[model samples]
Target: MCNKHLMVVLIILAFDLAVATDSGLETTQAGGGLENRPQRDVSCRNHQEYPHDNICCLSCPAGSYVKSACTSAHERGTCENCDFDTYTEHDNGLLQCLKCTKCRPDQEIVARCTNTQNTECQCKAGRFCAPDQACEICKKCTICKDDEVKVRNCTTISNTECKRQLSTSSNKSGAVAAVLVLIAGSTVIVAFLKRKKKFVGEQDSQNPSEMEKVVVDSGSGLSDEEMQNKLNGRLYDSPLLEQAQAVGQQALANKEKETKQGNSFTSTAHSSPASLPTLPSAPLPAPYPHPRPVSPSHPNTRDDDLPRKKLVPLNGDKSLTDCFSYFEEVDVHFHNRFFRRIGLNDNAIKNRENLQPEDRVHQLLNVWLEKVGMEASINDLIAALLHLNQRLSAENIIAKAISEGHFEYEGKQPRDESQL
Candidate 1:
């Protein structure tokens, strides 16, 4: 029995040993199968550095063209020189050399084509490309207009530039216009002055005795009122003055009769023919007040006693309105002279030609206030205007209006005295 147990244990040990040896052999065979598996070759170089047909080949050198492919590894292709107008900038494996670019009609070759570079183009002297980037064709340069001038001449890379011809032409035209206006104005003024002088000479010749009498009376000791009355009586034979004198005499007689009646009422009444009444001598009527000259030291005082003349609307159909209307009625040249005397600037004077009558009046008033340093009364302003007219010509409506006191008031009742 002991022998039998020992033999059984030995047989079991041999079976376990056999199983371990078989597992080790199977693992070795599996590892050897994995080691024998095939892998694809991944060492093929890029075509740009090493081109290939059946094997890899070297690239062509710079400044050369590839004419044929290599048949073996580590070898270059058949290389050749580029044609005259052709180029090859890099080691390209191309079958043919590149053709050079041709310049357009408006372009010129800046750099000629060579083995290593292409041609470069630029615009000609008088032409330029419309779009500068990679431009295929060039366009003609811009031409300046008649009223324009060239600022920059055209170049290979840039277009022509221009600027307007305004400064010289505008300034010259304005100066010429101003000069012509001044010359024409001066000519008109000279002619007007000569005509006025001739008229004055004729008037003096016709009224020599009257002028001499005035000179004689001025030296006399007569008061201004008496002198004026005497002058008026000698100068005019109008019925208005005579009628005014008769009315004054009638008023004086009525006052005297009232005074005599009052004395009789106060004293005892007597009914005798010789003691009844005595007629008071009628007093002479006072002369109408003459316009006072404007005193330089007291300009405001000139219009204090004068009646205020009512202003008429500029659009009114009445013969007279403001002083500006009188200026317009005279002549355009006379009006311009008046504006100059009032110290209006050139712009304002020029603008006056286009203004309406009312606008002109306001403008004149403003200018007068600025120059005279004071507000102008209607009478004083009109008197100054009339005075200006007298300086220009002898046949002045304003002067006659002032002398005859025709411009007293705008409404019905005319005043007796002439102001300013």
Candidate 2:
């Protein structure tokens, strides 16, 4: 019975060992399957990438788009060039390039789109928008009110700035003080006139001949002939003389009116006219100091006269300065040439190079004005434009000057007298 129990134990041990060996073979087969399958949750270097079949594929460089995914790890995908009007700004794993931005009607293109970079745009002339703010649309530039003055012109990234005008109040105060001074002066003059009349009457009663020998109250000691001449001069310069002149002018106007009436009545009664109204002679054209030279390009321009119209300032020097803003319309390509033609030196123009085109034009113009002093005129600027064959800009500036009341065509007055 002991020998039978030992045989049974040996058989059971062999069976247990065989079962453990089959289980080990199955585990080995499962481990081999895992090695052949694609990786999951794999780590990749920090760059641009895309996942394909549980594997990370490196992205294409800028200006390109991924055409295909990599077949294996540690490899890049196929890439193709971006089409026109499309761009990829940086290394991207995108299947297609991004579409380029289009500038709005109110905006202008600053930089065109390329495969490597997107388009850049900004507000056009006379408009602005802040970059930090949500720029749904560009805004119209602010025009300063009459009671305000422009501090800075509008730029693409900033709007126009204005400040309250200070000169208006100062002018009002000065006018009020001037009126008060005039009133006080009139009072003193009236008192002196009364006292002089009384003294003259007392002197005349004493002796008519001795009146000439008496010293005059005038600050200067003078001979009899000199005092008589001074008295005659005062009478000629007095308000009474002005009143007499006004009366004479009024009588002349009435006589002219009567003459017109007579002429009208005579013309009504007779076939022949009594008198024809005298026509005023035409005014001769004013001569320009430096006439614009006739050019082959401008066949219509006359050698005797400049093709451009002459601009007469409405408010003298102030009008010339006021029209300085119009010069900002000058073409950027012709800036240096235009200014140089206007007599600005190279150093003067170079110094203002850092300023914006508009501000640079203004500074260079101001420098030219200072150098020319009272001789500065808009005509000089216009002539310079003509010299440079920039007639269109010259004409536009003249139109703006006339339209804005800063200037007018010679011999032609603006219909609105208040503007003058």
Candidate 3:
């Protein structure tokens, strides 16, 4: 039974080996057929199609042109350099090189063309290219406004840039307005000063007695007895009444003496010329000094022919300073006018006038202190006085007052009137 089993196994193994040999023979035959059969040329499929020597072939690379075709299939063609101004961007089988692009009128060549590349173009100067628009054509730059200034000039790649003119007209207008205001202010000040001066002059010229008469007339509704009582009281207390009384006494004595003299002269005249005492004749009066010599041609020369009076300096004795000192003893109203004449404001004078007469000087000093600050000094006061063209007497009064330390000051000194 073992021998029979062994024989069957041997038969099964031989059959299996024969089958495997047949499969191997079939695979080898197939492989041999594939290797021996004519292979398809894949070179033409992978590369650009080109005709060479009546057969297909690979085309030439960039930067060069085909000079001649290859002699066989799947071979490269003979290539040569492209001419200047001509180009081919890719591997081509073209018979001739392509012509390079020309720059437009508004464009310029930035880079020259090569066999492997085309020409590069840019906008010309004073022009620009917009990326949003077709770059085939360039546009002109925009102009700036008349009132605008150029912040950046136009360039081939950028448009013009501008900015508005700043502060020119506004500054000019401001300066003009300031000048006009100054002129108007000065005119108003001058007019006020003139009017005040005229009013003060009129007040100064009126007699105190006349002013009293006007006052009494305004109160005319009083009874006669009341009026007489008021006049008696005023006459006893008034200095003007004392002066009038003294004048009346002197006039009565002169009249009595004149009457006695007249009677004596008549009696002497009756006694005859021989009785009159002989008197020495007085020497002839001396010829007048500084007699103006009349011109021969001016036969009708008179005393009026003398030269006109010479103009004096403003600071001389004849100027307003001589009159300004008179205000010291005058009424408060006159003092107010004096302050205004010297450049103090009316409101300040009014305030000062409201104070007691003894305190008026202190008030004036305070006003000056406010205007000039703490730097008010003797020198500064002198400068102000000189600017006003005051006389020596007025200057002395101020100097004395300052020396006595009647007022205090600090800070910067006062400037001249022109600077003010």
Highest TM-score scorer: 2
Superposed on all Cα atoms, model 2 deviates from the true structure by an RMSD in Å of 20.5
What C-alpha lDDT do the candidate models reach, one value each?
Answer: 0.56, 0.71, 0.55
Instruction: State residue 199's C-alpha deviation in candidate 2, in Å.
Output: 24
lDDT string for model 3 (1-420, tens) is 999999999999999879766554323256456322212333355348675544677788887778888887877878887889898888888777888888898898999888889998889876998676777778787666656667887777678787887878887997987787677667656765675565456447642221112123323334454455444444344444344445555656756765777868658758876654433122222322322233435534422232322212233322322333322443443455445544578767654443467567556755765676644433343443333333343345543433443422223233222221
Give the alpha carbon lDDT tens digit for every residue of 220-305 in model 1: 43445546645555324333334445556666686777577886643533444455344324344454455334443443432333
Q: Is candidate 2 or candidate 3 better by TM-score?
A: 2
User: What C-alpha lDDT does candidate 1 achieve relative to the native structure?
Assistant: 0.56
RMSD per candidate (Å) reads: 28.9, 20.5, 30.2
Clash count, candidate 1: 0
- Cα-based lDDT at residue 355, candidate 2: 64
| Clashing residue pairs in candidate 1 (N, C-alpha, C atoms within 3 angstroms) | none
Q: Is candidate 1 or candidate 3 better by lDDT?
A: 1
lDDT (C-alpha) at residue 176 in model 1: 89
The better-scoring model by lDDT among 2 and 3 is: 2
